[model samples]
Target: MTRHPEVLWAQRSHKIYLTIALPDAKDVVIKCDPEGVFSFSATRADGESFKFDLELYGGILLEGSKINTGLRNIICSIKKENKVWWKRLLKSEGKPAPYIKVDWNKWCDESESDTHDSDDDYIRGNSEDNDSSEDDGLLYLPDLEKARRN
Candidate 1:
């Protein structure tokens, strides 16, 4: 069954993990802060998890803001193993089709390795076509960093 975003889940203090099953692979734990910022971890179904900051546009907007707010859209690029499943899972919620890589840190770097290659016409074409730098993947901050420094 597809889970709707409006379904309000219990709120936890940066520790509550929501486990959602992928199509044919391991289930990933959705971890988030009290404010609703979310990150995913996949070390195990239930174990030491590494929080990944992979959202394309920083944070998801839960409510409509004066400038921009309303049902924040989450974004993340998954690994090859999880791509197919993720596509199916997020087909609904208007999820973008793997634009920028934030969750897969290693893959993102690897994919961009040839950006400096001189022979590759495709890479050169990209540079010539779009002069501006693409979004630098996603920025990940440790949960501790979110703690209020009182």
Candidate 2:
């Protein structure tokens, strides 16, 4: 029997990111259609077969999509036909498959999407500012020295 790999997905307005968590995959085959159908198949190093099919929430730009295979996963960058936020990854109304999940690390809400890009530009434009007050939105541990003094 074929096993299904864990699929983690996140999205921006214009694109979707699908990360297939399958280490050392071999004979990988992936297909995405303009009509929002996606198929994937691969074999693990130990000879286990893995596969899955998904009906995406919206049409995709097959020509603009890209796939990158890595040591631990395969990342597929799918370009959406229309630049809009999708409510969910799959087209179905109910719950998604057990193996499918949201990729919180890469998720960006629609309201934050615009600011997300600008934040990168801001960091690059202000590289010369090294003051502690100018942290680029990253979380840092509390300064123990300052706390002790207080």
Candidate 3:
């Protein structure tokens, strides 16, 4: 029996990031067509087969799409033909499959996309001229007792 791997997706206006979570996958095959069809298949070391097909929300630039296989996941960077934000990942969506999910870590809101190129940029912007000795962008809250004393 074939299994569907968990897929996480995030998008920028011009590109989509698709991540297939399958550790130690072997004999992987991925295909993306200009008509917005994305297909993937792979086998695990134990001989279990995994596969899925996604009809993407919009047409893609086939020549610009890329795939990278890693020990933990396969990442596909798909360039959009129209260079606009998609309403959702799948074309025929009522609700997406259970295995598919939004990649919150990589997701940037359309409103914020212009202000920050990425999460790192937002962090860096917050940290600029930070009074703390540590250069980490995280804000440290003052202790309640210390604030009360002051």
Number of the top lDDT candidate:
2
The root-mean-square deviation over C-alpha atoms between each candidate and the true structure, in angstroms, is: 18.8, 8.5, 9.4
- Candidate scoring better on lDDT of 2 and 3: 2
Cα lDDT tens digits, model 1, 1-150, are 222221111111111112222222234445433233455544333333333433322223322111101123222212222111122122135644343222222221224434422212211112233454432112233347558653
Best by TM-score: 2
Error of 2 at 59 (Å): 0.2
- Tens digit per residue, CA lDDT, model 3, 59-137: 9998756666768888776888987889999999699999999987677888766554333432221234445432122
Error of 1 at 44 (Å): 8.0
lDDT of 1: 0.27
Please write out the lDDT profile of model 2 over residues 29-66, one tens digit for every residue.
99989999999999999999999999999999986566
TM-score of each: 0.19, 0.77, 0.77
Question: What stretches of model 2 exceed 4 Å from their correct place?
Answer: 117-150
Ranked candidates, highest TM-score first: 2, 3, 1
Give the per-residue Cα lDDT of candidate 3 at 140: 32
User: Could you give the candidate ranking by lDDT, starting with the highest?
Assistant: 2, 3, 1
Error of 3 at 22 (Å): 0.3
Those runs of model 3 whose alpha carbons end farther than 4 Å from true positions after fitting are 116-150
